[model samples]
Target: MEQHYITVPISRDNPQDVFTVNTKYRVIRRVGSGAYGTVCSAFDQQHQRFCAIKKMHRVFEKELVTKRCIREMKLLQLFSNHPRIIQLFDMDIVYGLDEVYLIFGCMDASLHDVIHSQQPLDTVHAQWFIYQTLSGLKYIHSANVVHRDLKPANILVNKDCDIRICDFGMARAFSQTNSMPYLTEYVTTRWYRAPEIMINSHNYSKAIDIWSAGCVFGEILGRKVLFQGRDHVDQLYKILGVLGLPNDISFWDPSEAVSAHIKNLCTTDGLPPPTEPVDFNAFFPSATPEAIELLKRLLHLDPAKRITAEEALKHPFVQPFSDSVEESLVPPYVDPQQYYIFEDVHNNSALKSMAIQEIEFFKHRMSQQELSESLLTNNTDGTITTAKRSHTAAVATTMRHFDSSSSWQL
Candidate 1:
């Protein structure tokens, strides 16, 4: 290791620390701990802002996993200037070794975490997630980087609800030519993998992402992973039961896939779509008809006929629903030091225990005004009032706190 890569002057309050970067990047605290390495909240000394620092374990000189991480890093570096994909900031390499540290956007919660939580995200939240997923996927495809490991866990929703795709440990770049060889990867989290991938198609396209997006959309609608298959074949059946099988023998060759019968039973001489429209209303009771129809189109069995990310963005469902997306996707307006359910004075108090006449009451009678405004406004406007957004976010946040920290006491 180089003795003097670089250093910034700071008080040496602790001298026994193993990490001696002493750069502008001050580790705020560890936010996430994983097998690969720990992700910590950090302050970007150079940029003077908060960031997430990912320090991946540098296993060997040429380990496959390390290479995979590098490949993802390359993609991030290539697309670092974009808005949709998670931004990769300055890289930190251990002075004398091959190890690297990454600083990126620090976020609030992962989509997977929320999906598993008892308090399911409502329609407004779901739609916003889907919209951002499409937008971010569009950005990745534009750069020819197909996010192979797409799932709720890798998608982060920041404090203000900005969606950022993270954990590119399995992401591969696809160019004009195919980079993801079909039989090569059965790598994604099974519930969100594509059918072609399930059957081991070696030369797939960006359509793999389309399939995964369909899964994500369903998860949003159903408030759980739509097809939680314990294995590969089970996942295929879950999808087939919903979308039916593709009839076209031309696209799906039995020679290529494990089950030729899957194609034969679903298709005739030509490619056939699903026998019935997916029961979208069953999954999303409150979703607009347009949104349901859009989901149907996106979940098509034939990848060729699937809706492209850009096309999905242009769909009637998305355009009409964009106002809600903009509102939710924008950085959340939660005050940095704001209370959720419990105020500053009631820091250690229980939400339910607090009386209606708590210490800090919002002035101007915002609740009565909000209720009256809600009644007068038409449903078409569809904007969740600031008061409402604040209330819901607060409720969700506090519920999470209570669920995890119920044992806490003053």
Candidate 2:
């Protein structure tokens, strides 16, 4: 796969130069669609492999949709080589048609599919999957990226149980230099969503991902979603019911009006008060002590106090899978000089133009590949392009992270 980066737009003569999707990739079948766009599997004749092609409908039609597509494209490019993160192969934009196609390395099924199949997972299987999930997230958070949506459905896994975090359309960069983006009132699916996000916390952090991971951790062990809330309000109540409101005074920020809002809603709804707080051991009786301890840290009510991805990787629960003590320790989070702003992708014409520029850059890179030669030869414009592919450094090695039992047959 090419790893080239193109920042400037290239000149094109005829539309055929960039409109080679139909000729380059043979559509296998429609895979799925969501609120964002439609996706399908396609055979890449040049690469001789199956790839998932995400067709983002009406990319340029609305500012919100446009920003979403561009953000996903850029984030994929940034995290392309991470072993546990989905890989981006190529991307194309049909200039005149306003169509955007994002090509990604294909995988068999999602964790959601495995869990929903009602297939039971043993402790080893659950532990390994959780380790890899944290490994991927550790890399992401270390780079100052936040995957707002970390649910079973977004976690793709193959028959071997190797997992890749996918769907970065909702991800954004947040670090010391880059101010954290505003937290959406309610992001991620209700069952997997964090309490802070559900209650519309003004200031949230990477802990959101840890909380969601805890929910997944419990789901895998229990073979059911940990918190099956019907809506945002219920979701908060659900979290409170199990974990109970954090007795730690620092848990709730007084200035954030969401705290009061939650209180009023509970009072207005006339829901009964939470019962005795359920300890982690009772919550996940099958899990070992180390596993339960990690869950407790991850599911903390205070974002400031929650276990970080880096910290979680070194927890005793994951130590059995740790390859090397040094390797398992994820680097501390370092703030980048600047982050790609989602809003800018929509409001700034200069930034929006980067989408086409990246497309052209990718086309120029593909034109140089021996396998891509014939694909571009069909160009009627009688122009040639060439560029060397870029290579991103691989993620540092850690634990084996999986075994034969890792594969989910179901």
lDDT for each candidate structure: 0.60, 0.70
**Per-residue alpha-carbon lDDT of model 2 for 73-152, expressed as tens digits?**
77776676677789888888765667788999988778987776645566666766888899888878777778888999
Q: What is the C-alpha RMSD of each candidate to the true structure, in Å?
A: 17.1, 9.3
Model 2 clash tally?
2
Q: Write the per-residue lDDT of candidate 1 for residues 1-410, one digit (tens) a residue.
A: 22233332222564432333436677766566665665777786655788887766542233344444444555665554444568776555563444456778777677776666664455557656787788777766765557788888788865455568777666665435665332243467889888777665564677888878888888777777887776776677677767765445345445645446564433234543465546778768977787788788777767778888878887776563443332222123422112112222222223212321221122124345557876876456766545322234533453322133222110
Highest lDDT model number: 2
Q: Which 10-residue window of candidate 1 scores lowest in summed lDDT?
A: 355-364
Top-TM-score candidate index: 2
Model 2 ranges off by over 4 Å: 1-20, 182-186, 248-250, 255-271, 324-342, 345-352, 365-410
Q: Evaluate model 2: give its TM-score.
A: 0.78
Q: What TM-score does prediction 1 earn? A: 0.67
